[model samples]
Target: MVDQSHSFYLTSSLQQKLSKLVLAAFCLFTLYFWPQRFELWLIQVVIAVAICSYFSYTIYRLKSYKSSFTLHSRNLFKFANNPNEFECKVLWVSPLLCAFYVLPNTEVEDQAGKSQLIIVWRDMLSDSNFRHLSRLLLYIRRNQASG
Candidate 1:
């Protein structure tokens, strides 16, 4: 199904692929530095393995976060599985990539909105949807600037 101008869905495969790429890079880095120093190399390998395990676990936990998102008027957005809507503010923008991260419109802030960081990577979205979302995000930014 086609998403509206204000709505977009994230592809799980893309997310998983990106995560795998990162994990693979870490693995490759460790392998590339393989040395004959058994003691030191073992310690380095253990540390690298630990870091990769932690990162994989974090990604698994974040799987619970909603994958679908819709932008409502007045800078409000709600996740598909979530009913409540929260006001959002643009945290960063990349005109070239039509990508950005949004934060909750609140006084207190953390890593991201209650769950995950709202980052839309170019590859995560289709060209048309990305263009529409880019325009919508621009509109939201303008409202923020004017008010």
Candidate 2:
């Protein structure tokens, strides 16, 4: 692959859909376990209101989130909202997720003690970019493990 930076908008469409589906399933599960007879109608109303509130708030939060990322080779990445592009070390990688340990400052740390692990989700980028990133991350994962 060329040593070019890939700018990605973190819309995460697929992940959002999957999460919504899972949450909807959980709501259904809650309904299944809910009382059969409305003997205590007040308790039923409370349960219903609580579940709906949780579901709505979660959906709102998901929809409101917006971010952009730029990956500049295996060792460097930056958030678009941030001004500086910082050096980060790759921690681990899988098909669906990759973790990067970002140094606290712009440079690499001695012990990496202040490194923060940030997750890059699969759906954060386009299909081609995500695949390219996955390959790069896998390579980094291999090198990190042995070093």
- The model with the greatest lDDT is 2
Model 1 residue runs over 4 Å out of place are 1-5, 13-40, 54-66, 95-116
Off by over 4 Å in 2: 1-4, 27-48, 60-65, 84-124
Clashing residue pairs in candidate 1 are none
Q: What are the per-residue Cα lDDT tens digits for candidate 1 across 1-147?
A: 122337788764455557566876767576666676867787877777877777677667656644788886567777777666666666666643443444554654543456335767666677787777777777778888989
lDDT of 2 by residue, 18-112 (tens): 66768866775676676678676677677777877777777777766677777765556677876655666777677776777766553544534
TM-score of each: 0.62, 0.58
Clashes of each: 0, 0
Model 1 reaches what TM-score against the true structure? 0.62
